[model samples]
Target chain A: MVTDKHYAALDQVLELAVLINDDMTRSLAQDGLTVSRTHLLWELRRRGPSTQRDLADALKVSARTVTGLVDGLEATGFVTRQPHPTDRRATLVTFTERGVRTVEEMERGQQEFARLLFAEMPEERLDCFSEALGEILIRLREASRLTDPRGGDQ
Target chain B: MVTDKHYAALDQVLELAVLINDDMTRSLAQDGLTVSRTHLLWELRRRGPSTQRDLADALKVSARTVTGLVDGLEATGFVTRQPHPTDRRATLVTFTERGVRTVEEMERGQQEFARLLFAEMPEERLDCFSEALGEILIRLREASRLTDPRGGDQ
Candidate 1:
């Protein structure tokens, strides 16, 4: 039934996501970075240099959109474009020294933020929560492979 | 140290959020409604007949944004604006018959979505996940109250 507590928890996830997103937006704005921009930077930091096409694929954005993000970041000296060593036609994007610093700062900030949000939560509980979330994520990924726009009939 | 599995879990939560948001966006677009628009509709349905000011507050939007949403809904005969019985200067916003039907459909769609996303989980695990998520929400609400921008940096 819709009144079920489990359903309420699912709804809470959505509500809490909105709140956290607001917080993240404000925090990123202070750094002059949108979440989208920071996300690209984070990806580059994690995966090291990548071609524009690869980034476009990884971020699920259009090639033109990737160019725009890369251009914006490059213009600001947060990233640079280089000819790919393996592929002559494509360009690779990597963090500038400044970009690396921002990624570090963002990562540190996120860690602190997570700790604050989860402070005093017992370890065993978190383990269970983490495992539950992991399993749910796997299920979602699998379910997404099916072609039901309504998510599913079930 | 930062590469710990717990950090990975936290990061997964953000990734999963992006995926879910993308799904919601695509789902809402099919019905000619944006997520923001449907979120307001959902709120109105759950709480019933709120003032524009209250809607703005509840949705965490500006008064002007609320007017725009209400105007759009009103234009489509999905909601109505009428003088408040208690307050002369204020108006109440409530769902029309069409609006109620839309709300019901949206709720059912969301349930189907949730079911698709969480199908086949064991009941005991779901109970644990629900309880864990509930506790995490409480902590998040508590953490949000702190003044420091880095989520209190404590």
Candidate 2:
């Protein structure tokens, strides 16, 4: 049985995660972007141009949601959809120069935010924290897969 | 300098966090509730009734957002807003019986989801993962305080 202390700890993690995401979203919003949009841009920057379905899969969002996000980004002149190199039915979504700059700015902000957050922690503790987070993340990912068999199979 | 491996691990943590939140949101939506709304109900159920500003602080959302959410909850007969006992300018929000049931259902879903997610992991590894998550959570909370001085101060 899960104890109250365990529940409290889980609640703290959930609350902190929400707050961190909110701050990141607000920071990105100041640059005329939402976290979702920033994430798409970041993925493109990291993995090069990808089709809409590929992005939807990677982001774990529905294809319709991805289409709407792409439409918004395109309207903002941050991305353009070009014909896929080999698939006639597929379209490759590439970032514009503006998108690149925006993503870089967002990345810089995130890194700075992270650095400031960790500035007070001892280096060893920071290392521990990072490692611990990594382990939990792996567990959570594996767990999420089991709960969503469709997600796991994909 | 952060090693490439460490950086990769951090990226995995970040991605997994997003995915988990998405999964939770979808799960909550299936029960005719959004995570944000259910969060308020859970808070009230755990901590008793609270003012809008207090709820906002606890949820790390803006007061305006909380106001809208409360409005919707009140309309759905899941919550009630009453005058604050001591603060004339504030209104206390509490969960109704329906609200409590809703929160309980959401919690059950979440716990089951977590159980499914970790079923495959060795118990020892699960404990380690939980401990690591707890440590990182503590550090993240401390770090967030430094970056946002106004957070939790109100």
Q: Residue A102's C-alpha lDDT in candidate 2?
A: 82
- The number of the candidate with the highest DockQ is 1
Q: Model 2: per-residue lDDT, tens digit, A52-104?
A: 99999988789999999999999998999999989999999998898888888
Question: Which run of 10 residues does model 2 chain A get worst, by summed lDDT?
Answer: A113-122
Q: What would the per-residue lDDT of candidate 2 be over residues B85-104, giving only the tens digit for each residue?
A: 88899998988888888778
For model 1, residues B1-154, the per-residue Cα lDDT tens digits are: 3336557657667756765766677767744577888888988987899999998877767899999998888887889999999999999999889889888888888788667545566667777777777776676666565543545333
Worst 10 residues of 1 chain A by lDDT: A145-154
The alpha-carbon deviation from the true structure for residue B94 of candidate 2, after best TM-score superposition, in angstroms, is: 3.6
Error of 1 at B117 (Å): 4.6
lDDT of model 2 at position B17: 61
- The TM-scores of all predictions, comma-separated, are 0.83, 0.72
List clash counts for every candidate, in order: 0, 1
True contacts kept of each: 0.37, 0.18
Over the stretch A1-154, how does candidate 1's per-residue lDDT look in tens digits?
3336557657876756765766677678744578778778877887899998988877767889889988888987899999988879999998889998988898789988777645556677767777878887776666554644544433
Off by over 4 Å in 1: A1-3, A83-89, A117-119, A147-154, B1-3, B83-89, B117-119, B147-154
